[model samples]
Target: MSSHLLPNLTAAHLFEAILAIALVFSCLLGLQVIRERRPPAVTLAWVAVLVLLPMLGVLLYLLFGTRKRWELRVRQRPVIGCETAVRPFDDAHVLDRMLRRLALPPALSGNDIRCSWRPEVARRDLLDVIDGATERLWMFIYMFEDDASGALVLDALIAAASRGVRVRVMVDDLGSFGSLAAGRRALEAAGGRMVRFKPVWYALRKRMLNLRNHRKIVVADGQVAWTGGRNVGDHYLAAGKHEWLDFSAVIRGPTALALEEICRNDWRFASDEPPDSSPVWVSGPQGNACLQVLPAGPEYRDDAWQTALVKCCFEAHSRLWLATPYFVPDETVTNAVLTAARSGVDVRILVPHRSDNLVVDLVGRSFLREVQRAGGKVFRYKIGMMHAKAVLVDDTLAMFGSANIDARSLFLNYECMVIGYDAETVIPVQAFFEYAFARASRGVRTIGQIRETLSSLARLLAPLL
Candidate 1:
């Protein structure tokens, strides 16, 4: 019945076959949209694309629209070392409960936190801690350039490993691939073990490329840890054309254990090796600081860090100061900050005068005037690129981490931050913000002043950036 009919089939039959295939794909995609149960806007957008451009739309959705596969696998498969490392205090608050429910350790007290904006100071602190490492050292960095600054750290790691210390380094595959081939070899030659997280490979899932390990963390002997926006590069530590003005917080006490756990978890995920079962603990309360190490990524049910930051903005009674390198926030984030400013909470955003990303800079420019109109103040740093990601709410809390105020950091990449709830931590962060703000210019011209057509077009494509 089919042999002669297939040969005799005309253009009309071919067209009907193509239409039937498209209908089948469109229906399957619609079923997926309902099954994933994403936000209304996201679901509608996918449906619109599928209806308009059937073939290309299905391909793009399959590549990037799929939920975080790696995250889902990690969450569903319980690793042997996923145990509670810290105990909650008696007076645990709402934030503490929320974090605990997410499988994070309790916000422990008796912690010491130091915030430093000076790159040299932070670099020295990092080196000193590494040099002091006697037992074990673990580092997770997004980028490790093969420059003078990166050499110093790599040399330290090699020396530490040669001296019988156990040192482990995990770098993002795509970000530090060049550096691994150039400078990081010495550390491995000296007996240190280094692993790349999710290395780039052809035919690998497209969603895996975006789900990078963006956390910048270093732990020494399970007693001290350093985390923030600074990467191992000359630009972060020295003054140059593209040098960044960044900050890192040195954490001590029980909080350091929390940071260690994050490193252990990530290392296991990348290497498929069992984490060290030995627990990291402190003697007792080192200081009055109370801190929690919050880790967020696509793996979680919600964007925990983004939700926490927005919650902090709304809860601020006096002032909310946020300084970030990139300022491409989603509508939800923008509205939260705007509502705070409109409600008489003094809101100030300090972004770099010139960002490293041109498209990101343009998108940020589009929001400056609107935020300013809503009672928030926008200041552009007059000096070098400000790469610090920090927020201060009144005199109570100070948070600085690897995540920026951009779509990628908020939604896609894995990020980590230590939130301090004591004055000792907040005071130093506030002081740093004050110092940077003094050098920033308050006379920011709106996007309308800067050329509306280009900026408007950039703003419309913000989701892609």
Candidate 2:
């Protein structure tokens, strides 16, 4: 019926096959060379996938590449009635009493911030006040494992929702990739709303790998709030039977208003329903505490946390204390710490003895030499991963929130932090420094020489962690 047409079709198919095969082969080689300096195992795994399943492999890499932060461009409406709105708490004494919830500075730009290290205490206190707020609840987490303790938190929220609380939860789709879908189903069935951040689909539209919402925050009654490193997973509270050292806090007053605003902004960007803090919590007779809320993300022009830390370190009158699970120092941070130590400032850094991410762990160790040489002290927690991000400056200024001392925290992830100038708060935070140091392993680096030959190359690539 058509020998000529059949021959043409055959020729076209053969050409298509050759071009597709050749294209994939070139992509595989390119990935290999680009990853030549990475850990051998990591590079090999990356190569194998791209070569064996070029389409799917490239898609996977684009979704979860070696990027430290990931985000999107979405315009957001400002929160009205934001507690952070400039206002005076009716009774100076009353506002001061509520401000006591936070370790505030004498004053703040808009609102103040207070930090609580007792994760459970913060959660319980916030919930007690949220008991009858049957309007709404929203939460986001980087990870959500199916564990008993995690279930407990879920149950509580679900119970609240059942009682007419509008509960909505969003989890990092890629972070909890390996979990069974049934886990999320439980929340959905319990009258809670659930969604995943960037679930993988077919190919294309993948390259935005560096953006991730590593923020942990909870808002109840749109008045009280909690934000920190504590995710909704059980391992955070030792509920997974392997709880190590983790920290979080309860922040209220004006700063809490900003906290609520920030969370609502995020929710708006994600679900297209911008949040409005109508009748938002207002500052009452709170103590005269100076507190500032710090929130940063990919769209931010400057890393506020990093700037504050650098300032704190350089201005330390006597001592500085920092607790972080990961430690990947950037140039400015490294210099500030060094200068502070050299200036006779007692500088102490607490990092997890073992880190969840190996790449960052090595980079942290790599910077030890320079830190010690400058008279700074580096201590590794022995009991467990020291997952507390606390910076007590001069025993007079204190900061706590989601940001770490690492580059990821400084520039990559969506992080929140609060700084205050209060001895009452800073003193308690610094007092615990000794206990942490007691449980930490001092670095082997000699004074002034940061010899981290072990991971120089790794640190070089960490700009991508």
Candidate 3:
């Protein structure tokens, strides 16, 4: 054969080899996806993508599809000081029992729970908690910007560290990249340590880029704790006119110790160093409120927080109110919400008119319509970006924390929430919801054809998102 002919033949063989490898990889991925037992829609989507676009599907699966990371789980230390001795299955409240069964901390009474709906109040309380830290301070925040609010908190942390307080900070690498450098250096210079949760480069190398640490927790001296959807930024602190509507809760009791344990576990996971010995303090009931800390992440076999939230929805007899910035719920949660609404429970969902994420906003419209059809009320906040994640069931239970009502939060990211089952906690959350509802416009029961078509298309890609 001629030289040109031989070269062409070699190129053709290389192309054929690539095709065979792609086909084999796609087949293996399809089988693994099925074996993972994901939702039917998600599984089918993955299978179809692999069958049609094998190479791209394989890359996508590696980056975003892989859910479980056994290494992370193995490296994580066991529950140190948060586990309950006896199962609370016979508890009066079904949610309490269910949460205990899921290995969450038991609800402890006598905790003083204070919820802050205003951004400025939450910021002030957080800074005060930091400045008051006499022994140790731990913070696991998703977004720690270098703006005014961040600077203020960093200054507090630096002062605490300078005064011989053990300060440890953990922030998401992707969420707070380059924003924490100055803070970290200053903190470290003052005898503190700061670490990133799943650094971007490391996550990419491990093929776990989608798993983010979205938890926002601050525990000072193991006596007081602050947690909620609010991160460390000017927008969250209401420094500007376009502030995001958010809230955080302060708890003083054994519940604070539980949160501190979570922070320690997270810090250990990110820094690969065992947490320093905790200061010894008498942890007793501080007030009349009962609170439990529910933490969820990919390290666990089941989605504990999602299961609890769905259980709460089904258990709601009088009312169920949810406030989330993102609302792309999965099938189980959607069904729970619809069932409650159909059963004559007052089901109301509050979301922003337009969230910061355009795709999430579009996808959420479809889910919101489903709720509306099931006799649920949808309230779209119009004043500003609603960034709070809160849930109120009946007049007794309230939950608020970092998890959004979306797949990424409920399934992919590390999240934490405080569940309060008493008048004190419920009343404050109810007031927050009432305030938001008053400002929000009711979602229209009808949609135009063009908007409905776009929403329909967006719903199809919801599983991937």
Question: Top model by TM-score, which number?
Answer: 3
Candidate 2 residue spans exceeding 4 A from truth: 1-132, 201-206, 239-241, 274-283, 286-288, 445-452
Clash count, predicted structure 3 = 1
Clashes of each: 0, 31, 1
Model 2 scores a TM of 0.74
Per-residue lDDT tens digits of candidate 1, residues 343-401?
99989999999988888887887877778888989988988889899999988888888
- Which candidate, 1 or 2, has the higher TM-score? 1
Quote model 1's TM-score. 0.89
Rank candidates, TM-score, best first.
3, 1, 2
Listed in order, each prediction's TM-score against the native is 0.89, 0.74, 0.93
CA-only RMSD, every prediction:
3.8, 8.1, 2.5
What TM-score would candidate 3 get against the native?
0.93
Candidate 2 lDDT, 1-465, residue by residue in tens: 598699999999998897687567648654643543433434566677677766667667765544322243323344344344333555232223333333321234333344454545655644553464567776777777777656667677777777877887776666666663775677677777777665655212554445567777777756566676777554575432366566666655565655666666667655756455444445563445556566666545445567677777766879877888877777778778888889898888888788788767767777765677778888888875667788887756777777877766776677777666566456656755667788888974442324445456666655455
What is model 3's C-alpha RMSD? 2.5
| lDDT of model number 1 | 0.79
Off by over 4 Å in 3: 74-88, 275-282
